[model samples]
Target: MEELFKEYEDKIPAILLEELKSSIDKKTTKTQLKKMLEALYEEYLESMVEPGESVGIISAESIGEPSTQMTLNTFHFAGVAEMNVTMGLPRIIEILDARKNIKTPMMEVYLKEPYNKGKDIRKVAELIKETKMSDIIQEVSINILEATITVKLDRQKMKDLEVRDSSVKRAVEKQLKSGQVKIEGDEVLIKVKSKDDSLNDLYKLKEKMKSIYLKGVKGITQVLPVKRKDEFVIITAGSNLKDTFKLEFVDTERTTSNDIMEVYENLGIEAARAAIINEVYRVIESQGLNVDIRHIMLIADTMTASGSVKGITRYGVVSDKSSVLARASFETPIKHLINASLVGETDPLNSVIENVMLNQPIPVGTGLPGLITKVKK
Candidate 1:
């Protein structure tokens, strides 16, 4: 086989050759092998992009057309009304814009070994689900006359949340360091340390008790254990990728966050790029749109090419464009033009936008060819 394709060895890619070699079995014939190679070669040629093609425009149009038909709403999770996933046009927009803080930031956390096999999933969910002081408290009553605040703890709720009286007392004392917190049966008494503490101060302390961190992972507002295929997974309302990965039972490789910047910062630019493409594709596919993955890949590559996740907007990827005309063409023409002029920038008319701005044929496809004159010899 090597001798048969010796002439075309340099032409064929090494990866394709390796794939062909790995796919062949002992019973495979020389004729069958030759035919398969030919078919693969044809496929490789057919998939190649044409020189000077306006791929950017094509990609934009491919995705943009289907996006208009997408629903501008989130899908509610069955049995969990609070867990609504941001899908459709809004989700696509959020991903493309690379918003630092997403509206409904979430995480799909995969577990390892026995945990993934559905062992103690509810307990794991309870452990990670952020428990605030307000969640366990039945009510708060302030006694202005006594200059003290009384917080009634829900013992049943605390038991369900897997929290103890000692833990609650410790958390309250540590959180309200300015005040003295004493656990009296199921009630927590908060008294101001200052002898001259006013009624307003007592009221303020009572209000502060509502948001104190009691237990569980920070930023993980809610966690729901879900069964997928043969494994159990945790879907969270809020995301904290960095800390979530540190959990012993978590499958770090499979865990992902919806926030692009969070992924970029914690996972790296490459992961962010993949996340952008997958996220956009997921949104599009969820809406039953058939936009090609290549289009999403182009958008993802553009967003993460600068070693950082950037939005497709004027302030993000557009602002980083080397071509002044390209930047000006996106949005805010005056701002781009003034900034370019102030910096003594020159438009070489090498790109599509700059050439088009001057009422010239854009340097793409047939327009890319320069006129050549022949001299008689």
Candidate 2:
């Protein structure tokens, strides 16, 4: 078996050979294994793309056609979680357009050690959420004539956050710079120093105090600790990958955000490219579509070919085209043509769209080959 494996090691890909070696039965004869190896090699050869194939156009069509079947609805997870994730066509569009601000930014955060085993998972989740002043406070009373604001903090909530009254007083003082913050038991009183008896100033101060930044990662609007298989994971609505990674208990290796630009900012272009493929394919698979992974990979490759993610839009990938006619053909033809003509740009007719515009064969498939001859002098 070792001799036979060594013989086919050079003929077939290492990955495929390893998979075959692991899955193949030890009881099988050498002849059977050799036959199986030959069959896999033959199958692999048949799956390869031919030279000069217009793979870009094919991949575009392959992805574009199945995308039409995807519904434009967002997936609202059932039960107590109540999280809304943008799926189907809208998500696909968001990804391909490379929109920085997506409709629903989310993250699946994995934890380390005992935290992943549902131990203090709720506490872990609470710590991951963005805690505002309103979250820990029970009520706010505005004194009209006195020009003062009274805030009642929830004792249990404050205890859960492990915040001291003195700390709360300082935070309140820092937040509202114009007022004097006084702590009375569980309540915080804000006295307006301007001596204005108007109701407007007090109400504005009350509203401003409600949103004072508290502990926890900012922009994490909600967190749900869901038990997946044997481990508990956090699914957050608003994504803050940079801040999320800073937590001591977070397993950064498996944790990921759905935002492409965020991933690109934290990781490099290669990670961004992989993210594009995963995100697009995730949406496709969720919609029950059967597009090939190679198609998605090709699109991802093109999007990140320039060391940065560029959308398949007129202002992005289309704008970077070398051929003047190719750029003009995408969208806003008059604008592109006018801009090219003003710059005295020339079309080499080396690509598809220009040759098609001139009623000539496209430089693909059979038309890709050309003959070079030397004349006898």
| Regions of candidate 1 where Cα sits further than 4 Å from its true position | 1-39, 76-82, 369-377
The digit string of per-residue lDDT tens for model 2 on 49-139 reads 8889999989989998998888867777786757878999999999999998999999999999978999788999999998889988898
In candidate 2, stretches whose alpha carbon ends up further than 4 angstroms from where it belongs are 1-11, 19-43, 143-147, 192-204
Q: Cα miss at 50, model 1 (Å)?
A: 1.3
Residue 95 accuracy (lDDT) in model 1:
93
Candidate 1 local lDDT, 1-377, one digit each (tens): 66645544675788888877887888988788788778877888887988889999999899888888888767766764357778888888899999988989999999989888877788988877889999999989987776788889999999899889888889888888877778999898887777588777777788788988987788898888888898888999899988888889889989998889999999899999999988888888878889999989999999999899889898898887789988888899999899889999987778898887789999899898899999899
Q: Model 2: what TM-score?
A: 0.88
Candidate 1: what lDDT?
0.86
Q: Per-candidate TM vs. native? A: 0.88, 0.88
lDDT of each: 0.86, 0.89
Instruction: Indicate the residue-level lDDT of 234 in model 1.
Output: 94
Best by lDDT: 2
